[model samples]
Target: MNNKVITKEAAAELIRDNSTICTVGMTLVSASESILSSIEKRFLDTDSPRNLTLVHAAGQSDRNRGIQHLAHPGLVKRIIGSHWGLAPKWMEMISGNQVEAYCLPQGQMVHLYSAMAAGLPGRLSPVGLNTFIDPRIEGGKMNSCTKENIVEVVKFKDKEYIFYPSIPLDTLIIRGTSADPKGNLTTDEEAMKLEVLPAVLAAKRFGARVIAQVKYLVEGGSLDPKSVVVPGDFIDNIVICDNPERDHRQTSSWYYDPAYCGKIRVSPQQETSKAPLDIRKIIGRRAVDFIKPGAIINLGTGIPNDVIGQIVKEKEMESDVTITVESGIYGGLQSGGIDFGIGRNLSAMISHQDQMLYYNGAGVDITYMGAGELDRNGNVNATRLGSQCTGAGGFIDITQNARHVVFCSTFTTKGLEIELNDGKLNIVKEGHIKKLVNTVNQISYSGKLAVEKSQKMHFVTERAVFEMTDKGIMLIEIAPGIDLEKDILQLMEFKPLISEKLKTMPMNIFTA
Candidate 1:
């Protein structure tokens, strides 16, 4: 076996100028930090590897690490990924017109890697039809600098589908838990084994150099056959890192927790027991009412993340329902902040590809997602609105499949204020922006399609609750102390069908 061990600096030097590189992870979990950090260091020090394209199926890291480390203006020429919400520096580069960005559906990007690994020309699907990813629209272009059309909308038997042509990958950088002397990789202690196999094989199939970073070293054949995920034959080089416990997990705040890696079983733990107080907490309590034991639930990022955590802490139903983040953590203490999309005492960790397949195939029972703006027809904008290009990460894949959906949001945003007095809500001041609009600026969730499929749809807010009815959204519940005509009808852009059995939301959700 050729000597595979290498220094981080040497690994960084392997990347050539103007080569396309592919990465892994979403919102911090399973991201390649050591290599990305080294690459960033190399570029900043010597300005080599300029004009390189970065490819990822999902957002690799937050502002501090992962792909965010390589956000320099000239180092990256283009980026093809599903989400950029976590990479603020890269977003800034796109905002400054110094980098080209293209955002596609997370599922499509993952499948495209599989296609590449299989030596296929490109991946074909109807996932991006009628959405911004279609060529007729922005064509997956996120910034002004991206000139090439990455997606094409083609017709098949009177049906329209999108085709994502695979690009030649020059290098692949991935991080795993261990490697034998021959470079067989294992994810024994990682938070997630996210697309390691696909990314490695995809790069190798295309004659690209594959570099891996590992936490520990092992002698040849010391690693269990089943434990070794990526074969040593394909890995070109390996970099063993010491003290991976320092910066390897999702965030610096957390060391490795056995629960997150599925090494331990999960039991009900009291996260919180207080009644919902904040507006998001109120919405979460309402969403909890929809929860049924043993049902699989996927929580969207940002605010919906809070809703689920508040419910788990307040109700201590950690074991009642199976909770999954889009990044593939399940049954642990779902947290927020920089540690979003991770489970503290998780039941299992999986790859983003498997989760996407489950989502696209309707394996999820229901999804609780955050919405920025919603139209009267129940169309929710989870991604971009107007010039703000908050790329739809897994939003399209999760919503397009799971027929039963509950969208959570405040009745208003920006400067909305309310008073909760004796379990009664009083609107002190309305937000400058109304979340319920006449028409959504973007179609992240199709209420019309949901209605056509007879999917159950519910919208939960601190002030009001609505359900999809044949005649459009029907107001079903309102918070106590809120006037039906003034607070509910006057606030919305259009009138909804008032439910014949209109009732007030539960007081238990408000008072401690």
Candidate 2:
């Protein structure tokens, strides 16, 4: 194996048309942006690949950089990964029938690629059983409207397991801090401790090419052998990016710094809008009823984003409460403030993975997430709604591990009318449709698992609040100004069991 270094352009040329490529990175972190830009430039300069299949545990860099330049405009045909939100262009491509997008479970995706790298037949896990990802539902179905690949139930020793096939890789693109002339690499500080080494090894074992983008090229024997993550023996080409700015905080070798923000800079514009209360705000405020003092909470994007505002306004809990994001950021009170605060003293910045590992270990006492569609069986589909589907992001990990989970959204979207006057929400016009459905197109997180784990779960909307019980979804409360029969009952796909002690949510939530 030669330890030769090349230009980023040369590395891009190694990727041929119609090849299966695996990108190494999680959302917004450790993506090889320089290499991705080079690929985009190459595609623009020459004939682009057709029917290219991208395989990865997550589409971190490809979606953000590659999709806009090459992958989305019909240049690429197939995408197999866990989530799709990081790349807006790729989502559009999938929706337009220009590409085939297959969604896989997060943990299962990691296991699948690891399995392939190890020369295994496939991966067997209990993650996707009884959900839409189940093969029985759609055989991991993929279409313009749907993205999930079905999970198959295989009974071994009378114990059921979901089987996910191993997918071989033709090329692996990874980013690291530095590479020795001998090709030894290190990712000691990278975000997720991603299986980049195994991915590169998988490609190498299959006689495929491995391309690595690094900030610098060191002497042949410069890098400590023990510190090397992917040795030169496995790497085929090394591209020197030279831009230390891009490499420093991204490679994960550097200590997590408060000054280093990602490509998307935190700005006031991106902050969740705060104004007069609407149906969404009403639902968010009502979710506060579930919060307890001294609880650690994780807030998902969307309606749940509004909960922080309500919490701050209400001052409902003691000062011991903590709030976190799914990205693994913690102690950041993000209550529609001028800037999202972080840590004590409102530090507003923290290491990303630290938050993920915390939630992964079920450190969060409660979690609030937004949902697109939910069923009587308590399955929630927040990933895809109509023509819009955001990646699961950290929804699965947060909801699965949180002690209590709350799904917050309006009873129906699209022209739903509700107004706030005198600090109270008044439903003027109920949206003529229901967001709660008989079945969800995809199950982003399993409510059954929440029940089995004895975790409390609630589906809270402007119209009603339903709790998952041993029997099923039970109506626990309705909003202050909602009509129980006309608004809540008629809109639900299935009849919700009304609790004998159902009550109206408090209007003066700030005082509650």
Candidate 3:
């Protein structure tokens, strides 16, 4: 299984025209930028694979720059990914019908790759049973151009499960922090856990070629055996990308700078507010309720950022709770909010593969995530909207395994205003649209699975608290001074089952 180690250009040559390629990266964290660049250069120089199919857990690189460049003019014909917001230009192409796009749940994509690697016919699960990902409703539909194949629906233990078939890969492209001369790779610096080895194994099992991009090369035996995530036997080609600054989370000893937020472009409809109290700080405090002492936790981007800070404020659980970022940093204190926090005490900062393996196996105790929309069935749609959405990022892997999951987001968006004063919430302006909907454009997480696993799940927003029940999603409480009809019902596309004992959330959150 000796493979060839070559330059980026040499690796790019292996990707032929009209090929079905699988790239390994979970979000902007572990993407193989150099290899993507090589592919882009080849695509621009020659008319390569006109009908290219991309299969991955996450979409393109940060901000969609890499995938955008490759799929721009006549390069890519179609794309099948869990999310595509990394590249807004591609969304434009999708909207125009110039490029085809298919959206699947992020966890489903990971399971698909796992099935492909294990030589299974496909993945069998109840994850997307009655949701949009179900074969019945467009079969994980993304746009007019792309459509997924829903193999069948079968009864198991008198329950139903939808079968999503495996799609073969012709090529697998991955990025790693370092590799040895023999092709062993490790990604200790990335944030999110990616299915790098699974991608390579799946490609190889199907007789597909594997292309890897690395930052440095070490001696054959230098990499600790325990740390080698991708062995040389599984890799077919290696491209050395010398740039080290691209990695988002570096070693704690090193001075790490947060990724530039770029431009803060809020949707015109999104309401902006400034209060004496940072809403993010309060949100972080609320997340602390989900944390348990001596538990490992994964924090998603956005509102979940507050979890780390809130957890730190308690200070008592600092030694007990281990906080990790999906970007691959483990241990220490993880700050919450957009800027993200640092881990104070340290344990082990492992690579992307190790993180995924641990999380996928349900090694984590709790995970906090932010959602764009959640439905009555408990399906989460954080990836796509009408024409724009970010990559699934690490939402799938983290939530799938965590014992307890918390999704925090405002109940409504777009000029819906609320004020907390004198221990009461005052509705300033009604939000224009409902965030909790009857159906979502995409299924990023399955509520049914949460119920099956008896996982603790909560939907926390400023206005209400809801939980998933066997019957459906149930409303447990409303914020203080919030009207059930005016604030809750008017803001939700669907009515949640309410009990006579439903209570008003305490204004003094700490006392509640």
Which of the numbered candidates is closest to the native, going by highest lDDT? 1
Provide the lowest-lDDT 10-residue window in model 3: 257-266
**How many clashes would you count in candidate 3?**
22
Indicate whether candidate 1 or candidate 2 has the larger TM-score: 1
Look at candidate 2 and tell me the lDDT of residue 14.
Answer: 78
| Best-performing candidate as measured by TM-score | 1
With candidate 3 superimposed using the best TM-score fit, by how many Å does residue 202's alpha carbon deviate from the native?
A: 1.8
| Model 1 misplaced regions, further than 4 Å | 242-246, 250-252, 265-276, 309-320, 385-388
**Cα-based lDDT for every prediction:** 0.80, 0.66, 0.68
For candidate 1, what is the TM-score? 0.92
RMSD of each: 2.5, 5.6, 6.7
- What does candidate 1's lDDT look like per residue over 1-512, in tens digits? 66799988888999999999988766776666777888899988898879999988877766677788889988998988887777778777776778888888988788788898999988888676656677886787877778889778787898777888988999988878888878898988776667889888789888998888887888887888998889999898998775576557745346676666767655655343453468878888898788887788889887678667667655767667888877777775676756666666666777878878888876588888888877878788877655566678888888777857889998888898988999899999888887888987677777777877688889999989999877899899999999988877877898888889999898877886
State residue 161's C-alpha deviation in candidate 1, in Å: 2.3
lDDT of 3 at 120: 93
lDDT of 1: 0.80
TM per candidate comes to 0.92, 0.77, 0.78
lDDT of 3 by residue, 301-404 (tens): 77675444444545456677777775456664453332242333335555444565677775578888888899989988786765664546557667767888
Q: Residue by residue across 217-300, what tens digits does model 2's lDDT show?
A: 777777877768787888878888766465333422233433233213345454434445555566776787677777778777
How many residue pairs clash in each candidate at the backbone level? Answer: 4, 13, 22
Candidate 2: list runs displaced more than 4 Å: 1-3, 59-66, 117-119, 144-151, 179-208, 216-234, 242-257, 260-282, 292-298, 305-365, 389-403, 428-433, 445-455, 510-512
